[model samples]
Target: MTVICEECGKVYHVDPDKLDRYKGKNVRVRCGECGHVTQMSRLMDAAEEPAYDFEKAAAPSMPSAAPPQREMPEEPAPRPDIAYRTAGTEGRAGWLGLRGKMVILFLVIPILLLAISGYLSQQLLRQMATDITDESTELVLQEGKEKLMQKARDVAKQCEVYLQNHPTLEREDFFYDPEFSMLAVQVVGESGYTCLIQQPEPERGQNWTIWAHPNPNIIGIDDIDMIRKALGPHFEDFFKVLGASEGMRESDGNYMWKDPDGKIREKYMAVAPINLEGLPFLLMSTAYIDEFTAKTEYLKEYANNKTAEIRNINVGVLLIVIIIIGLCILIYGYRLTRSIQYLTEAADRISVGDLEAEIDIKSKDEIGNLADAISRMQDSLRFSIERLRRRR
Candidate 1:
């Protein structure tokens, strides 16, 4: 049997008995000349190369009439130019050679850049959230501190007013004064502190009984004695400032002073001297450092908890956004890669002369446009080949 390629005009000889293999298949035999694979039916015709019966044709009447032997034709030498052209032609075949590579690169680079941009954006959001959380917590703590300071000043002011109004009363008599004594008691109750109102003996500078209210169980009169001992040397200075002040002196309020027993302590004290008829008296209100320290510690704990909650909420939001962005990137990449794969497969088919292979990519994107363009090129080439064949 003889086979001739419709595409490149290459011919092959095959046994007629082997024809069954080519039936009902889309198989094409490769043409060596153009490197195109033409359909088996298009390449072969069994009737063109009939089987010969050599024995019947060569029968006996030939003994004395045998023909003279003729010179054999030499085999043609290989043409280097043809070989080079065939190799060059084969190399130019295939879609992904250069154009396809460029298309793949165009799709892949953007996917990579989008992923990187998403990661960077997530980082920036996290940093901004952290900074805002820190600043907000600090502001809360500052406000709490300011409120505590203001409360301390109010208590000090009330104590000074009581003494100035009760003139001439002895330290003991001053405590017995119902109006002033009750006022002092009320101030201590509201201040959230264990306070003592003392009127020390004139010779002792002031001797008074201490009152305890709402103590945190660890602090007491003993703590007060320790505080008084710590403020011993600063006692004169405290009285001098107290006597000179009307509204609680700001400088006096923050100063560290010593009491009679010489121990170091911070005291918020306000004193007012009174002379009632012929007696002299001074009313003094004192608060220990631990009173304000406890409130500050509570504020610190509250601030810490609030900051943690904010951080947790911020992290949750960030993670959700990151997950959404990741999913988008994954979906985008999959679609882009799938379109390129389709183009690659179509190119491979077209390379082997299957110009009927078409890409079904329907996207309106650049890759889709490229696929459409290639399909058009294939149709145009097929049309040209058909026109050339009709002319022949």
Candidate 2:
């Protein structure tokens, strides 16, 4: 499109694409020839007028002896160069520059990923701790049950030998005789004891009777109902083990036992039948199962504390990593953006014919290479201008 200086009638050729943004609006432009500001209308596709021929209009009026007049220097033509630019007249809000974008890419995204990894690691650690505790508890219980069964068998053998030596000792008189009662009642473990009980025989009017026991009140009596009342729902397990004693088979089981303080605790019991003829007595040993797994409980608590400590350390490490990354990006991004700003200002100055603009950026990275290239271009422009000045 053509724009004519209304003051000097000088014609200027303007790219139609440059006026696209001002479509349907009035715009003003300063003429390069006469500096005359002209208001252009939105109807940009007007017919091109014939260019005013200044040379032809002046030549006919000049004499052959007249000297030529020097013309004023023309302003440099505008070039559409796409480059990193700052805000013009129209600045956008919340615009993230290169540094801000870099922080999001290098710092924020990595921190999120680290947080996710840390969460998953803690969950996995908790699951592994739970599994190890369960397996260790089971292993200790198995070993304890075997030891308890062996202890019951050994005590049963001792009772059979003692009863064989005193063949005339009756079940009713066993608790009264101190020597026989001592042999029948033995200590099994810490807070546990072994006792003798007779198998049930309904035809002879006999029931589950305690012939010898650590407690004198329960000796030489039918204590089955009292035990059942104390055990409540847990009596079935104890009864099953006792019933198997009549078949001459060793029986071992676990059951809940209520203590004097109203605390319900799990207990392990083992029963071993006596081999003596005409003797329907069996030796039973019982103790709390917690006594065997006490060490395992301590170890589990220790593991939980250590796991919590390790998790704290992991959280600290993650925070430290994020801080380090943030600091690095801030330091490096600031330096990098400052160097680019220096190059931008230098380039802007050089574009306006200021060939003396200094570009002092020096580093070992790509930005340094760019600074060197721009410095060479500046030197070249200076050389070209000096050469042109000398020729003139």
Candidate 3:
């Protein structure tokens, strides 16, 4: 015979022959519906007698005709301990749900903050690069321009000495002498300037070329009027700035000036009160602004390109960091959400009456601890429900 436990709903098999051994005693039969062992009197009650036998006993006074058999009602199937188990499995509304929410919130908020931080960091880096580039460009240009000015000064000094040594030739002949022209020729050659020097009294000018080859190119002139016309009034200021004296004195060093058209020029003009042969003369060397400014343009371009490259690299690094952080957050959120989903489903099952449902989580972190606590609570509730059912 199969019997169900009253306390734990465990089924047990018993032999019918054990009924005699159990007679006259309070037999402890384990309930199939629960694990509890219920005590009952060994004697069978009259209620358990067959209906035919009871009818026979009741009709004894009459002639013993066979009594009609009445149909017996079917015994109802034993109800399982659904209520107890359901009550046991019901989850307590405590910090577990809140904890899961906190986990999800923590993951999401940090990701958002990281994105904002990365954007701001990139902006700051770009600004710093730009500032550094600007400073570098300024310094390079300043140094280059200074060096070019110094070279012009040296060239002017050499030309002044040459004019002092040759003092016997006539003003016209001195200006025209190929040997004396050498100093002016060398000045323009070394100074990186396209130069033309004019001697008004000789009615002539010399154009000096210097930028390649063994020696400087020189041209002599005899047209004084043409030279004067080309010199213009600007030459007067140029000569004044150079401090040219009317006698045998040295000319001034190179002086820079901006013309009305905004072009910068360096000029060194000297005059001999008397020429090498005691004749009057003038010598001038001028270089245009393009010579110095050309070098600075390259520096500016380099600074701009370097700044752009640095900014791009910083931006790329920022993007990579952001992407990595975002992906990590997404993964964390996915796991957290999945855990919460499991907890929710477990809670739902408990609400409807399945106390044996277990909450298992893969993580070893706080969420895992929460799941463990929930499982333990379910087990405790089951124990309590079983105790109450047994007492009743």
Backbone clashes, each candidate: 23, 0, 25
Per-residue CA lDDT of model 1 for 68-127, tens digit only, reads 434334333222111111223444447544444444565456556655765666566556
Whose lDDT is greatest here? 2
TM-score of 2: 0.75
Point out where model 3 deviates above 4 Å: 1-161, 187-191, 194-284, 293-296
* Residue 191 in candidate 1, Cα distance off native in Å: 5.3
Q: What is the model-wide C-alpha lDDT for candidate 2?
A: 0.77
Instruction: Report the C-alpha lDDT of model 3 over 37-82, residue by residue, as the tens digit.
Output: 4444455452554544544564336555756555444345453222
lDDT of 2 at 146: 86
Could you say which candidate leads in TM-score? 2
What residue runs in model 1 are displaced by over 4 Å at the alpha carbon? Answer: 1-10, 13-37, 41-173, 176-186, 189-251, 254-267, 272-282, 287-317, 323-325, 362-368, 390-392
- Name the 10 consecutive residues with the lowest summed lDDT in model 2: 80-89
Q: Please write out the lDDT profile of model 2 over residues 31-149, one tens digit for every residue.
A: 66555455666575656443445434533467868787554344334432222233332234257988999899999998999889989999899889988988999999898888888
Higher-TM-score candidate among 1 and 2? 2
- TM-scores, all models, native as reference: 0.48, 0.75, 0.49
What RMSD does each model have against the real structure? 10.2, 9.1, 13.6
Superposition-based RMSD of candidate 2 using all C-alpha atoms, in angstroms? 9.1
